[model samples]
Target: MKVYDDKHIKNVVFVGAHNSGKTTLAETMLFEAGLINRRGTVENKNTVSDHHEIEHERGTSVFATPLHTEWRNYKINIIDTPGLDDYVGEIISSIRVADTIAVVVNAQNGVEVGTEIIWNYIDTYHKPTLFVVNQIDHMNASWEDSIKSIKSLVGNNMVLVQYPLKIDGAQCIIDVLKMKCYKFGKDGGKPEKLEIPEDQKELADHLHNELVEKAAENDEELMELYFDKGTLNENEMRQGIRAGMLNHDLFPVFCVSALMDMGSGRLMGFIDNVAPAAADLRPEQTVEGDILVRESNAPTALFVFKTLYQPSLGQITFFKVKSGEVNLNDKLVNSRNGETEVLNQLFIMDGKKREPVSKLEVGDIGATLKLKHTETNDTLHEEGKKITIKPIKYPQSRTRKAVNAVNQKDEEKLNDALRKIHSQDPTVEMEFSNELKQLIIGCQGELHLATIDWTLKNIYGVEAEFKEPKIAYRETIQRSSTANYRHKKQSGGAGQFGEVHMKIEPWYEGIPEPEGFNIRGKEEVDLPWGGKLVFYNCIVGGVIDARYLPSIKKGILEVMEEGPLTGSYIRDVRVMVYDGKMHSVDSNDISFKIAGAHAFKEAFLNAKPKLLEPIEELTVKVPEEMVGNVMTDLQSRRSVIQGIDSEDHFQILRCSVPQAELAGYSTNLRSLTQGKGTFVSAFSSFQAVPRNVQETLVSSN
Candidate 1:
């Protein structure tokens, strides 16, 4: 291994839908570079990228694996990411360091829903992107249809650099930009370059002219040269394509059969020749909005993008040098917490293999051993520098469940494991809900939850169960009511007596105060749950001692904590202690508190109490034909259609549904659309539950 400068280092990320041959393409790329003796297949579960045991069992990638290949004099750092949306956190973290995005498309499936989902992120980042159509050797592969699909998704700027054709029962790719034909042997390696055949000359010329025009469009000089000579050479085309890619104005398409190793060598050659290297990318911004200098002369800084825990190794932290260089024993301070961390050892990682290196320059990805305080998304920089690299922002969780240990003794151990897991993958989060009295775990979907479950049992040896999460429903009054309570306690020494009269009303912002009562003192409080409480005192004559006023308010709040209707948190209520009586010696704070609580409870019950449940605003994207099916499913969950909009060939449905009905919506939607539907949801305002639903919930409670 050699330390390549930022100019020769290209950071590429592979993303696509499952079965799109992303892992296979990565394996082929490594083998083609002569970095690996033999290529591994996903079916055999021996691939370098999907090395995890869980991935082997599932036959899919579970983590983003970083590997390197040297083509010519360039070192390509490849991050092979998971195609399943469940592991999208892995994809996003990998993309943060990506200089170029290579979106692999399966020829059979074309543009899938998952591809569209991943495209949104790439588009948002405006990363230089290229498309690779894989599985060209398959029996049912259709290159033309795949091109159409690619054009539809990426628009007209997608130019075909190569197209596959069967030459006498063998696969031969016609390179339009180079104006040549590549014919491969039966073993599918090192294609023989030859002139275009006579029969295909006209078609190749037409496509070649198209590529020339596309390349010239980005540069005036090239455009002039194209008009004068009616063509541009391969080097000129490469230069124009590189410019277009850096600007994200053009996306070139290539075809490959990764399993058969037909076009991977050509793909790597193009990457080395045209893809933007780390130094060619725009300087990344820091958290403070200052651009970072991606050079060895700048302050040394490393962005910790991922943290993984292995039973054999305690923890492995993956990072990319954002600036300057790092040596084996360099001490860098974490910009997040100002804690100095020692880089004990550095290794260039290839799957589970570690290639020990003495130094890593800027833009090179590598791993290090445990740092007590360093976690994912943290920035470690020179001691005096305040540079913090901008971190990767992950999507919000789509599923939540109450997780509890089956064996009570493992409860603490379960929490420890979960916390460690959260440090490894930030998308797996845990929170304790005081209102529901449950420890809830949130993740992308059901598959993510299953992985958590498996890790608990397999890695931590802690058996756990995931149950339906309890909704944090709220209680409020619908109408005004009045009630009075008297507390009298008899004892041998003395007797306690207190009486209170209160008027309870539904509270709203900008509502007028009570019209009839002469208000003396007022106290308004913002409830921690969600609403406000307006407390007024009309005791002009001091019927009860002023000191007891605080006690009365406290009592009312106590009842509000556990509402009379369903014991949920009560919010948005107005309480007025208009009248009260007390005995100077017997009516202490305790007596007043009891009377106040009783009065508030009685009035709450009579004031037309209502139960409110959380509402989530969901935006679901599905194909046109599946809209009806999605609509039907939403109707069954009592979802209200807010609006619908169309984009491309899909329908975007904006819906409002109760969170209680959306326990396993992700899995259900995937099944309904055959993995062609995706959605995102956020918490909206709460609304009152239906009468029958409220009755059932109350009775169950």
Candidate 2:
């Protein structure tokens, strides 16, 4: 392999919905570049991009695999990403470093819901992008519908570079930009370039003029040049298209049948000639508000975007050279922890294969093995430099399951495996809830969790099952009440006697002091579990010593930790120790604590108590036709619809629902909408449960 300069390197990522031929297209590109002798298919389970065993079992791409193709004078680095949104973590990490994105669409399905969902993320980054209408050779494929869908996605920015056509029972593509026709053979290898036929000349000419106008809209010089001459030359048009792509003002569409080896060569040629290079894209801003310029001699700075742990091998760390150049044995310090690491061996990754290289230039992506302390999203540079690249921000978990080890002896092992997995994929989070007494693992959805389960059984050799996680419910008083308790213990040495009288009431923000008592000392404590506890000391006559007040509050907290109605944490309650009796010799902290616990418990039962369950703010995006069915299912779960907004042909429905009612919401939503629905949810405020719901919960507790 040869080293390519910053201007000659292009980072293109393949992204789209499942079965859109993204993986196949990536395999085909590598073959066309002569990097591989033959192309592999997803059905054959030999595609370089989907080499993982888990992906083979699931029949889908689960990880973003990076490969390189040396085409002409350019080294095009392609990162093939999974089409399913379940592996969004992999997609996001790749997108953050990409200079251009290629969104593939299945011509049979047009633009799918999954495509629209992923496009939202791409649009936010504003990376130069193009659309690939693939599988056009299929008998059921519809180029017209695909064109309409592409136009809808980009609106007025859509520009047609090629359209699929069939001539004399063979496949052909009409290239409007060059006014040339490409005729493909039966085997679909290389195409024969010829002049446009007379019958289709009118349509070809019209689309060619449209392409020139759209390309010229981005650059003033191009616009002026186009007006001077009747049309722009080939090189001039390529320049304008590149300019339009960099500005995100135009998205060129291309057609290909990747499985048949048709049009992939042309696609690669266009990418080498027109796609934006890493240096041409905007410089990334560091965490310290510094810009990272792609200069080979500036400083040796590398950003670790991904980390993977292979059981057969050791840890593999993948990174992009942000600035400067790094050689085989250069020492770099991790900006996160100030630990020095030497690059022992560097290689440009092609799936699981590592091709060793002596040096990697700036703006180049490569991988290294066996770093001691470096992790994903960590910035490494020369010694004594403070530079950290902005880390990738992943979406919050959309599904949670209570995880348990099938073998009792493997409990600790399971915990360790989950933590390690979370390090590679940040979206997979793990937490131990003391209230629910269960270990919960959260991920993107059911399929995402399935991958985790597969990892545990195969890689870690631990058998684990996921169940529904229990909800963390809270208990609070609704009204004020007073109660008194006396703790008198006659043990040999001395008699312990302490009496406590306290008034308990619900606590709210900016709550006023009690009306009937004199407020002398007040301590407002904020509970760590999400509420407030206000303690009032109204001992006017000093009947109870001030020193024992802490013991009383501590006793109340013990009961608050496990609410009287349920084991859930108690919150937002005010307690007043107005008057009490104590013996000088017998009354101690223990005695007061006992009396305080008893009195608070009694007062809590006397007051009207209510149970509160967590509420989630959920946003479900689905087709408008299925809104009524989705709404009906939500109502059954006691969800309150906040609002509904429309986007294109989809509806965005926002609602608030109890966490207990959302045990299997992600799977249910997909089933209800025929796998065309997607949703994201976050923790909202805790609200009171209804009367019947509270009664059932209290009785069950």
Candidate-wise lDDT, in order: 0.91, 0.91
Worst 10 residues of 2 by lDDT: 112-121
User: Per-residue lDDT of 567-633 in model 1, one digit per residue for the tens?
Assistant: 8999999988888789977889889999999999999999999999999999999999999999999
Give the root-mean-square deviation of each candidate in angstroms.
Answer: 2.1, 2.1
Could you tell me the C-alpha RMSD of candidate 2 in Å?
2.1
Backbone clash count for every predicted candidate, in the order shown: 0, 0
Candidate 2 on 152-224: residue-level lDDT in tens? 8889898999998899998999999878899999899899998888889999999999999988788899999
Residue pairs in clash, model 2: none
User: After superposition, which runs of candidate 1 have C-alpha atoms over 4 Å from their true positions?
Assistant: 490-497
Report how far off residue 246 is in candidate 1 (Å).
Answer: 1.0
- On the 0 to 100 scale, the lDDT of residue 14 in model 2 is 95
lDDT of 1 at 292: 94
